[model samples]
Target: MKFAKYGSITLITFVLVAGIAIPLSPSPQNWLQFPVIPGLEEKARNILYHVPVAWTTVVAFLVSTYYGFRYLKTRDIDYDIKSVSAAGLGFLFCFLATVTGALWAKFNWGSFWNWDPRETSIFVLLLIYGAYFALRSALETEEKRATLSAVYSMIAGITVPFFIFVMPRIMTGLHPGAKEVADPAAISKAQAIADSAIAVGSKTFADSALATVAQMNVGSAVPVVQLKMSPNMLVIFLLGLLGFTLLFIWLLNVRVRLARMEYERSTHHE
Candidate 1:
């Protein structure tokens, strides 16, 4: 539909903010300070967009695996291709998610790789998905490869989420929401403030100063600070996102066309 163009524009904007702008913009000096008016801070800013990127990629992978299973059942080569595309996209996002999370951790937790439960789980997910790609390559026959890969995908799918969500809570780790230090309430509240600010704008120098002052005042002089976006950075992020999205769409269309051509050739030969 006509919406595709609009969608491309929106994604480009996001890519600009995430990839280029945020990094160039000034990071909050003290990211951990809680904002008084229920919204403000830098860590919260990262969570707003970075977490979602990671999440979208994870869902993409899962959906790919689902299609892989379907391809095995229906013997549809298209489904197999689609499944691979989704998984490939998923892996890209998962890797991005881990990198972004590492950036967040470095700022908040004082280290990039801490072997925390959350980190470990995601790392394992990366490994398992990597294995999925490896398994696909090891087989020679198209049908056999599809069947075996589908089975492997299903098994990995079942295990990855369990490991990502459930195992972390049960075990001790430095990640947030772990045993003996669970504090979703505080984290959620802080996150809410950050999200609200990011929705309006990113934190600016002035906003940062005001937030710092408000933090020192201890509620007596709480100020309402609005998020500010760097126009240049925003533009750059949008451009990068646009470039990637266009490439993805173009590749998908080309693949579909090739498949159609192959089918027509087979029919003509028959």
Candidate 2:
């Protein structure tokens, strides 16, 4: 446990330094080069910090749900404690991801609250977990509380994939990998096709746009596609991911131990 704790601290320090120090791909004077992203430029560097935290949030929730399920099967209060603890941490990371995403949006899109489908999905997720805590507080009996909370967490788990994956692709939004192929080159090609269609009056602009998109292989799947990172950026991102994962493990260990102590104390007094 100590090894995990200290290892996480060490790796997180490395992540912070490398993430901040690595040079982003520079804007080219000509078309032969691409900035990490055409419009995002240096702000694209947020991928290092933002994506890892977001990934961690999903991981945290999944782990929490796993423990919740375990509690259902074993009727172990310890699992219940773990479920809540993991969910608590997941909420924190989700908040961080949202804040970082908003900052990234403000930098790239000139607005902090565009209500993009991805953004809306996260908001709804927050509310879902928020209710988990509320329901937890409202109940007084230990066994009943554990059982119901476990069930509720499972129900909430159903939405996790939908919010993070499904909803974003189905709605047009400003976030990268959303429903739109907003890449500069793709957009330009789409526009040219639309214009030519309008001039010839042989096809609808929408039809021309769809044809261009199909020709370019642009689709909802493309927006949510993974960003292709340069070798250096990829290494740093992987290190950050490793560091955060270790941190989550260390935190879970600590929380579970504390919960065990509390549970023992309460039982002893009873």
Name the candidate that leads on TM-score: 2
Per-residue lDDT tens digits for candidate 1, residues 1-270, read: 234445655665665455433432234333222232223334645644465556656666677788888997899887877777777766777798799998876544434665667788779878977998999999988788878888888987888767777887665454434544334443343344445555656554234433433442343222222334344434443455444455445444455566657757876997
Q: Which ten residues in a row have the lowest lDDT in candidate 2?
A: 27-36
Off by over 4 Å in 2: 25-36, 181-226
Residue 167, model 1: Cα distance from true site in angstroms: 1.0
lDDT of each: 0.60, 0.74
TM-score of 1: 0.60
Which digits, one per residue and each the tens of the lDDT, describe model 2 over residues 1-270? Answer: 998899989988987877666555564343233345544556666887888888888888889889999999999888899998998888888899899998876544444666778789777767877888899999999989889988998998887788778876665565556666445555555566556555766453445344444433555445532457666667777988988888888998898888889989999999
* RMSD (CA, angstroms), candidate 2: 8.2
Name the lDDT of candidate 2.
0.74
Backbone-clash count (model 2): 2
Q: Say which candidate scores most in lDDT.
A: 2
TM-score of each: 0.60, 0.78
Show model 1 residue runs off by greater than 4 Å: 1-5, 11-40, 174-176, 180-270
